[model samples]
Target chain A: MSGVSEHVVIVGAGQGGLQAAMSLRTEGFTGRISLIGEEPGLPYQRPPLSKAYLKTGAADALTLRPAAFFEKHDITLVTGTRVDSIVRDTGHVLLGSKTLGYDHLILATGTRNLRPPIDGLEHALDLRTLEDAKRLRKELDRPRTCAVIGAGFIGLEFAAVARALGHKVTVAEAAQRPMARAVSSPIAARFAEMHLQMGTRLCFGQAVKEVDETGIHLPDGEKIDADLILLAAGVRPNVELAQAAGLPCDNGIVTDAQLQTADPAISALGDCAVFPDPRTGRLVRLESVQAATDHARTIAKRITHGTATPYAAVPWFWSDQSDLKLQIAGLAFPEDDCIECENGSVLRFDGDALTAAETINNPKVHMKARKILALQAPPGRDTLKRAGYDLTLI
Target chain B: MVKVTYIAHDGTETTLDGAEGDSVMATAISAGLDGIVGECGGSMMCATCHCYVDDAWSDRTGPRKDGEDDMLDCAADDVKDTSRLSCQIKLTAELDGLVVHLPSSQL
Candidate 1:
């Protein structure tokens, strides 16, 4: 089980960090695994924070693993601790007064919610972690008006819940359509309608000029009164630690397809890694659970078995907005053309090559799309059309 | 603690104490039992935690929700009549001795 040094220190004990530790053990890497997290409790999932956890308020369900799991897997989980710096030459990480050496280091620092430039931003709330969700849930308990600053998945998901809880909800997006960054315009249009149908107000092409305790002010000089304001604008990767260590940082920690940094002994994954997409050869950073766990598994395999195969897993993502679950397979670009399939799933193609597929409330189509994208040669428009848009045919 | 037994494809039965609030998938995952991937962390977005609820406890475990049923169709293994996404089934004190069979694979 021993390859090089015995200790592997992982920074950021979120989804990817925890998966790296768990996958290392499952891959038979019997080394000393130290998973350090800034959060004070067991590693938990973030997707539910904006989805079921908001409605159910079940904090335990968000936990990825319990304390017993760390003991059983021999994973040294250092909660409520942050790694200050990494010394590449000495292969050590400094955590406040303590310094721990590592045979290899993994950076799964993930990302933090980005707060847009607006006056009095302190009045806005966040829904990034369990703590944020708990606070937002408390705000939802009472009959209050909510103003979400973004129309991305998090913002829309929160808007849907806030509406369901009898709270007046208003989602304001700077773009013409909601979730324009992720989904196709057509799909975003459908979601916009769904929110409108649910008694939630949707404001497009509007930017927040300022935020006060009462509510948010639009650039058009319109004031919307809101008791709770949620800032779900977006997120930026936590790459300060890697940057301080002299590692290249783009939108995330730059890594090769093998997910290894310039320093071979160090690797990065999850929301914090900008790796080469084997399909499109584009440097992409994903924030989905699928990407995080898959990246962790790939890195674990390389560290344990020395199998340095380029990561080619087809990226998939899902967002639950009320009863409609939006699922996507593959990566879509802004210029990619979208085709509406018979099963109500939209397939995105970059010229001749299929880039991504988006589906709402259609898991079968989404699953088929994932399987198709995972292939060496994904089906193009002609093949997809000839197959009657049935993914099983190809 | 509610006792639950997860039978793997190889007929390896691993029984563990499950807390009342956590899902069966979470309990199995915490125990590090094989065959239950739980890729989506009980969101029903991924069918990696697909399992076959024993007929004896199927009624108590309740029926699969629409989302869970659709996800089971995507399970890597063969989807059976008793196939269920373990994540949707919350562990309860009443269902103390729940027994569910894990599929052959959960890629």
Candidate 2:
């Protein structure tokens, strides 16, 4: 067994950061946990911000735990505070006037909404944080025509909620199809059709050149009129702290399979960390609750339980758009082959290997895919074809 | 307020007060209770809040909803005849004295 840490300092107090603190205590760590977040109030989950919270306006439902949970769990939660810098040689993190020393430092800074270069971009609202969601939620009090900048998960989810609330919505995505980076072609096609049927205007391959009071101006000199605009284009990982601290940074902070940085004392997780994918051995940075929580569990175990296991949790994601619940199990690259099964489920294969499974309104198949993909030797395309591509049978 | 008793897999019982509109899983989560992860936060997407309603309350609770049983297949614990996603069960005056037995794990 390895040694236990005396004090674990987690920055960015979001879902992943809080999870590390919680998991450390759950793993029987007697160390001091300091969870510092840049945002005020309690840390909450982001997934519901686009779906349930948008529809019902239930803000309480998004909080991961109550305020008393920190005290009860013996966790020191610092809100509305930012870690200015990390003094690597001295194992200290600067928070304005104070210096906090930590035996182990966990970076869960997550990502910020990507604001592309467009004139009058401040007019577009964001749905990334609780504050952003609260602002957008109040704006949703009255029906207003909304033009979403991207057709990714957040963009479409927002479009669905806005349309369901009887608001006219238009989605402008530069990509030819929605969710091009994350899903299979068939899955993207189905969502495109669903948005069209919802009476929402979907403008694919349309690049916005400007965002003024009148709405967005397309590169083709066409314009879409809308009173409200949402910037759901995507996100840029918050790697400035890590990069400034002399940590390797690319698309995200580069970490090992164990999620530890080159400094050994520091580790990163969630949307900001690009680690090796256990299945494909490719560097990937996933922006999902699964990655955040799983990475937290892995890091916590490594620090408290003295387990040096690599992070290998199966990546699962869900998005509730209108009445369709799309769930994806495992990771699929952009160039992977997609085979839409007869039963409405789509399977993604990389060459002969089954890489991911996409299921719409089918939770059982999604769970089954997660189970099958966790195996040491996931089935090949021929084996899946023989099994009729049914995850249950396999 | 309704009185709900949660029995852990190890047979430890803890009773808590649940508001009429709150869910069984939400109450447990709010109280920071163990044995119920509630990962998806009560969306029918995840089945981490699986529980077995007492036999006395099973009939009143009724069978699993249309797609609930399918979601339960993802539960980390075994699914039984009395198995239900606690999120799907909302507390009411009639369920005041409800008791739920949590599985050993909700990983």
Report the error of model 1 at residue A38, Å: 0.5
- Please write out the lDDT profile of model 1 over residues A1-394, one tens digit for every residue: 2365488899999989998998898889988999999999999889889988999998977777778879888999999998999999999999999999999999999999998789999999999989899999988888999999999999999998889888999988898899999999889988998999999999999989999999999988999999899999999999999999999999999999999998999999999999998876889999889889989999999999988889988888888887888999999989999888777889898878888889998877777787788778776788888988777567
Q: C-alpha displacement of A17 in model 1, angstroms?
A: 0.6
iRMS of every model, one decimal? 2.4, 1.7
Best by lDDT: 2
Worst 10 residues of 2 chain A by lDDT: A1-10
Model 1 residue runs over 4 Å out of place are A1-3, B9-11, B17-22, B30-34, B55-70, B73-81, B90-96
Q: How many residue pairs clash in each candidate at the backbone level?
A: 0, 0
- Candidate 2, superposed: residue stretches over 4 Å from native: none
As for candidate 2, its clashing pairs are none
What lDDT does model 2 reach?
A: 0.90
Error of 2 at A245 (Å): 0.5
The DockQ of each candidate is 0.53, 0.61
* Location of the lowest summed lDDT over 10 successive residues in candidate 1 chain A: A1-10
Error of 2 at A385 (Å): 0.7
